[model samples]
Target chain A: MRSYRTSTVVALGLGLALLGTSAFAEAAKDITLLTWLGGPDRKVLDTLVTGFQAKHPDYKVKINVVTSQGDARGGMRTALMGGEKPDLVTNTWPAFRKELADAGILRDVTPVWTSKGWDKSLAKTWRDISTTGGSVYGIPYIFGYRSGIWYVPADLQKIGLQAFPTSYDDFLATFDPLRKAGFAEPIAMPAKVYAHSEWFETLLMRTGGPGLVTDLGAHKIAWTDPKVAEALRQYARLFGAKCCGDSKLMYATHWDDAADRIFVERKANFLQIGMWINARAISQYHLKPGTDYSLGKFPALGRGFDNASIIDAKEILATGIGSNPDGADAFLDYVLSADGANIIAKAGFTTPSSSVDASIYDPVAAASVRFVNEGDVRFVLGDLLPGSLVDEYRLALQQFIGNPTEANIAPTLERIEAAAARAY
Target chain B: MSAVDTRLPPPGARAAHRGSPGPAPGRRAWMPESATALLLLTPVILLFGLSVIYPVIETLRISFWEIRGLGRPRFVGFDNYLRLFSDPVFLGTLWTTLIFTVGVTIVAVTIGWTIALLCAFAPRQTSIFRLMIFATFGISEAVAGYIWIGIFRPGDAGLLNGMLSAIGLADLAQPWLGGANSALIALIITAAWSAVGLPLLLSFASVQAIPRSILEAAYMDGAKPLAMMWHIMVPLSLPGARVAIFLTLLSSLRAFDIVFVLTAGGPARATETVGFFMYRESMTQFNLGYGAAATIILLIGVLLVSTPAIAQRTKGAK
Candidate 1:
């Protein structure tokens, strides 16, 4: 009887200890995230979130997907000012990060960065883009390759071009043969606000090399530089030569249609866009990459000039405004870790942040890796300016492209300068 | 004494009694009644004050301020207003809105009046056609905008463009929404199409109420078809016509969805109306103060233009 009683007491004690641990585990932290996840992307995000939850069962997250366009960030700003903000927000444009920082709504995550070793894992370019005032505010979630020329295999074959050109003179020469063959337009250029901005970036990169744009974005260069004027003049020359489509059509036609004309209809030989352009072409036209089409960097300017590409990093930021601030930081840490980077790289995205191995990504994404590491890519322009100034510059570029004349250029540039000065 | 007074009360005594008054009622005496009426109307008054009057007042107040999104609204009195006046886009939008309003009003009212006249004189089975015609008014403006977009899509894949190409009129299949000059006109056509149904229904109701005997008498007195329409049907339908015009004018002035969805005030802001401008300023630009100021200006312009017409129509009705 003594032996039985002793055994029962031991079992009960063990049971009580397990119960205490289980209860402690059940006391999970909760977080709220606001994002713009819709359609197929929502499923991918859901999978990622579920994976996150499974790994950290002690933390619970609730996501609120807000459906909006252009006004989503503005609405969040209003909420931040009103003292009601989400713990995390996705799809934040770089221009507004300054405003949020200025407003003191964002949390300085430099400690989180150091603790998680992200400072060592992330690429310097990615770190540079996501940092403000020597403190990290966000993690680079997605990297988009923006500087490249798109062409059809058939058009290249017809023009006797063996491969895509890598120099400005050669690039212009390729277009001359196409124009001489009586192709109405060798390229499809849109005068829409966003489209015009892309063209301006392309011109800036092609003429002065991408370093000037990077310098301008970093506030190391002035807008009134002679190189800037030369770039504008080069764009005007192309506009005058009828190498591009009607400017009016630019206002109505979307970028997809422009891609369609280049890829499907074979109307245009070249299109300047980002990596997503290639993805859109593949999905829209069902064209196999490396066979039907391929990618190339924006041609080099001259000797000793580096072939510079444009890089835009999508960031995940932990905004301080809800329950479980620690949980938000934990989730961000998880995303910036090597494991999360592997998941993203497997999904056909470039993960240059040294956390993820390049061998894990598909060939297309691996190409982006090469572009960033081998090609020495730089961040896009207009990212350093305030949101209002960026909008004004976009509008000014749209106007200038539509009415490409020497008369309109000075006034447009002057207006942009005034807006930029006010911005600072 | 009572019987003699009752039997022999003279005009002089009655006049003196009637003329004698204890007090005189002046305009000030109407105050209490007016106050009671205002009090009774307080809910509606408050509603107008909140939704309409307050916004106008706030807009006028903010017009003098330099307010960005969710920031401290700073007073820069008249600077914004001055900038707006000097803005070419704003001026262009004003002109476009005016032209669009007038163009849509004329087309919508004319077609509606014609349809209503036909429906009034048609056979019994024509009620189905009338119903079908009037059914379009049930659709929301955004839906109507999208539907017309499918029809007027600039490419050959569009419904109208495909039809024209199939019928061997391919040469005429130019970009309908792609041109600056034709974009506003196309939007005007869409606005007319969406709005004509309401006026048609109103005019049909008024036309049916006209006395049939008067029409028969006119026919018997050797009235031709043209004369019968101009003299009999038109004159009787004038009241309905006036209401229809007023409604269409108001609708045209406030039209936003069609222009927004179809053109987005684009192709170089050629199709921008005051309503679209106000929305872009308020929502896209996040310049709520400036947007408010623009809204007030638009409201004042609309009221000034429409007040005389509304008063004239109301007086005519009386």
Candidate 2:
């Protein structure tokens, strides 16, 4: 009996030792991600995190979501202010990144980029866009072409256009024919908020190219510059073509309603928006890409920057306040890995990392990839603009849509310029 | 003890101090009336301080600093207030708020009082109708805004436009929320619809309080129904209607959800109220200091509207 008790005590000691070791191992730091992303975006982040956790079993990713009604940046700022010390944050707005950087909330990841040899996966241009004040703070993982126009192929056939228009004038010329084909509006302008500004932004890209976006965003070039005026004049030409319906109808429409007009009601022909609409088209409407709907590049304006495009990209930034910088850096490296990019592509998104398997993209997403690869790309102008100026700019554009005339353009530009001056 | 001696002490007597075993264990000993009152009010006062007073004080403090996004704040004093007054957008919202508040109060109170008087004549028959009207008050303002969106939608698919077309008035059928004037009118109509319930219930209660003797006397005097309604019921029910006007006016001045969902202060901001302006500045732009200044102005406006009503209500109260 004494021998048996002694043996049992030894066994219990071994078991307790094993449990204590495991408890120590499980105490490894968790990499918390603070984001305002929801729906499909949350699903994508969750997938990437699962892949990351699988590769690094010692680390776990905890995603903290900041919910808001509109303009999620407010909620994000609120979360940070409420003492959420997340290791990583997903940012889309360049201005917001600057704000965070200025506040010293972000860590300069320039050294990590070189130490990890990220240059092999991401191009120099991505690095350039991710930098502010000559220091890199984030890694842009996913991008969407903002310069593409969404169209239903069958509807184009009705207007006697065998394919989407390839030139500015040709695109405008098709409007009359589409209207003649029993459509009330040729192009649905969602002027209720900011989508109405999309056409003008693309026109600006065509007229003044990427340099203008950079200069205007920095307030280096005034809003009254001839280059900016020329862009607005080109936008006015859409009104001249009678491309959209009455100003009243345009003012009443939002992006979703315009999408409905294009897909559900079949009352309108085209909409220019970001790539989320592709997901919406496939998932919400249950439509096939390239067959039911397709995307075309904004028609060429015969400008020097005709080959250039605009895109919206989401980047992951490291925070200084995090407890686990090593884990956060490892996660960032994993995000740009071949496995990570492929996972993103398979989820119906385009990744900036060239390590992605190109075959994973659907035809429409493939087209967006092709168009973006064709030339230099800039972040969408709205995302580049300061928060204070963005609203006034959108409101001015909204007012312009109310009366899209040459007379209105000057006042509109002047109004935005005044706001910009104060904004800077 | 004798019955007279054992009788309860007169009100405010120090009964507990007389011979109360120094009050039971774990219970309070004798205290002055004011001390007892203070003890009773302590929790409520603390709660009020935390939820209401603290926020107001913090907001006032924030108004003095210029906080832009995550950037460090700078003390700007009253520059933000100065900027708001000079701002065309803020000034425009003030004008719009006045118009919306007055418009909603008149429309809701007038319709509600009329219906209440009409229902009072046939209380049993109109019970379901009264319930149906009051049901709208239970509906959330945001939900009501969404329902109105379908009605005021731009196209022929919209309910109002379809009804107009069905009635051979297609020429008059236009996008109800597209134009500045029309959008504001639609918002007012929706708000009034949501607000009409309270006035109806209040006025009905007032009308019910009319003595049956007085009504019967009027009836015996051969006074017509219209004469009784105009001379007696209308004059007597003014108190309830006045209260309704005051309430609806305050609610309308602070309208945001309906505006946000339906119009978003759009078509050149013709429908923006001071409340929406505050939200846009604070939440959207992260102009905390500027937004806080706007909030303070709105608080003052509310106080101005409420102080008179509160004074009149408490005129003879202890």
Candidate 3:
């Protein structure tokens, strides 16, 4: 009986000591950052967080990676409604910002922006897009240009093209001769949902300019509009080229598979993708930057929309509501500064902050910075639209890719318009 | 059957009269039995209330609302259900669900019943074959779907296409999942392949339970193999077969993983069944109310399709 009592007392004391230690650990955790940063993306984020912690040793930051972009968005939505929301969330897209802001689950960082004097450093377009009803909900972290064409410069030289084509006619003219030069397919087009949509979106931007793309994203204009039909016709014209081979080939190909054709397998010459393709080509395929492959502007198809670039800033850092708003703000301030941006640049990612010098970036990233700095209007396609409607748009474009005909385009657009009408 | 039996004491009274100091029939004899039954049923009843009853009630309640993501759910009355009739996508989803369920249930049950009968008459050493066939039941639905992906994948890399080309039937090796019409067939084939194990095991177990005396009698009475199967074995096994049918039907109606991994309801919403639609609405699109409404409709469909078989099973149980 005496031994039992003593053992119980000892066990109770040990349990109390362990519980107190865990409590201390919990109290010492200063902030939590929920992000979709994984694989190579984590390197820069980890460096920035470590730097922040070193500057302020009293603060300990916890990082929770939510796997993918869509999962992170969905998780943040659920976490906002539940307890235990993170202090800071990074890589949030514009699509989720307004909804979170409206739900009052996001803290307005406008005050932080003003106090830090960040309004002058951040790009005006990003600042405007991140603002919802005059409150900035997102802090721009990482940004880049999307829908840029990637081609092997040597392949282009072999086809007797001295420079990348700048106009629609010149672009189409290169395809046939490139095919005749023993290139099987001049362009590797993947009919996967996102790939097909990006192709159509690029064509639409060149055909009807940014205004039309904006209205479509806002759902103010239906997809069945004549302008959209014209864009579809243009896309079909390119897709039907002999240089494209059979559209059936696309059914088995994903976007990465299409990219592999040029960079890895050396089968195709050109691929229309984002600026990130350059880094992928360098790292994955071990291709030299200017010699093996290079970036070119997606040629302007019409007279009005000239040299326009659609930029997609995929990763945005924002604060959660009912969280440690002060800690979140402090971390955001630290990360958006010139020093922080340079750290991110060193890790091979571009930043939206103008305070970061263009020369700090690598040559490929420097080219993207030039696209933004050279008075090119940046637009994020479908950023304002609801996610479901965006899905409908992609699905419609995929169907059009499956069967590209004059007869099928109108009905496909109508179906997409019907989905858009119900988005609200 | 006779009114005079009411004048006599009930069965419990006769037993109680023979015993000493037990409760009288009119007063408290049933109390202890009832209490014991209540005690025994408590855990399952609590579980049923928690898992099945609560979610069902919540789903029914959410069906009348318009919920977007984790936003506040607003009551829209029957607007969600009423919109179903007008929404082309929902209507098409209903058609896809029906086609998938019917095709899978028929094909799986037929294969299962056929295999069960064959195994029932086979030599005793062929129990290994039964084990091998039933091993598929241990595989998860998602893994099964992935296994079929290699077979139905749409190029030279695909196992089926590769096999066809090697056998000099290259012209027939087209993209099997390229279009809506063909994608539906692929989904059905994959679903049936995964679903056959349940009915096979159930039918075999039930057939094995039949006494050998009946089979010997039928054999001695000069009943041929076909006649015995038609009139004896099949009739005896109908109860288990009906249960298997209902089980397979419900599972096929709720199949999302195989279709999700295979077609993703693509080639223009061709194979988008009710289950996939609900998932897309609730999880993907974050419209909980619409998804709830779809779930309720699918529930009604299952009940309507399986209620008769359930009643028959009950009668057979009695």
Leading candidate by DockQ? 2
Model 1 DockQ vs. reference: 0.22
User: TM-score for each prediction?
Assistant: 0.82, 0.92, 0.82
State the weakest 10-residue window (summed lDDT) of model 1 chain A.
Answer: A39-48
The models' CA-based lDDT, in order, is 0.72, 0.89, 0.76
- DockQ-derived CAPRI band for the predicted complex in model 1: incorrect
Across B1-318, the per-residue lDDT of candidate 2 in tens digits comes to 565667655444454556533444345547866787799899999999999999999999999999889888999999999999999999999999999999999999999899999998999999999999989888888999999988987677688988999999999888777788988999899999989998998889889988888888999999998999998999998888888888888898888888889888887788899989999999989999999999999999988998898898888464
Clashing pairs in 3: none
A350-383 per-residue lDDT for model 3 (tens digits):
8887767667776667776776665444455656
* Highest TM-score against the true fold, candidate: 2
Please give, for residues A1-424, the per-residue lDDT of candidate 2 as tens digits.
9999999999999999999888766645688999999987889999999999999988989999999877888999999988999999999999999988988889999999999999999987788789888989879999999999999999899967789999999999998888889998889888887889888888888899888987898899999998999999999899899989887888888888889889988999989999989999998999999999999989999987777888999999999988888899999999999999998998899999999999999999999998988777788878999889999999898888767788888899999999999898
Write down the RMSD of candidate 2 (Cα, Å).
4.6
All candidates in order of DockQ, best leading = 2, 1, 3
Task: List, for all models, the DockQ compared with the true complex.
Answer: 0.22, 0.59, 0.21
lDDT of 1 by residue, A274-311 (tens): 67765675676887776688776666666344455666
* lDDT against true structure, model 3: 0.76
In the predicted model 1, the residue pairs found to clash are: none
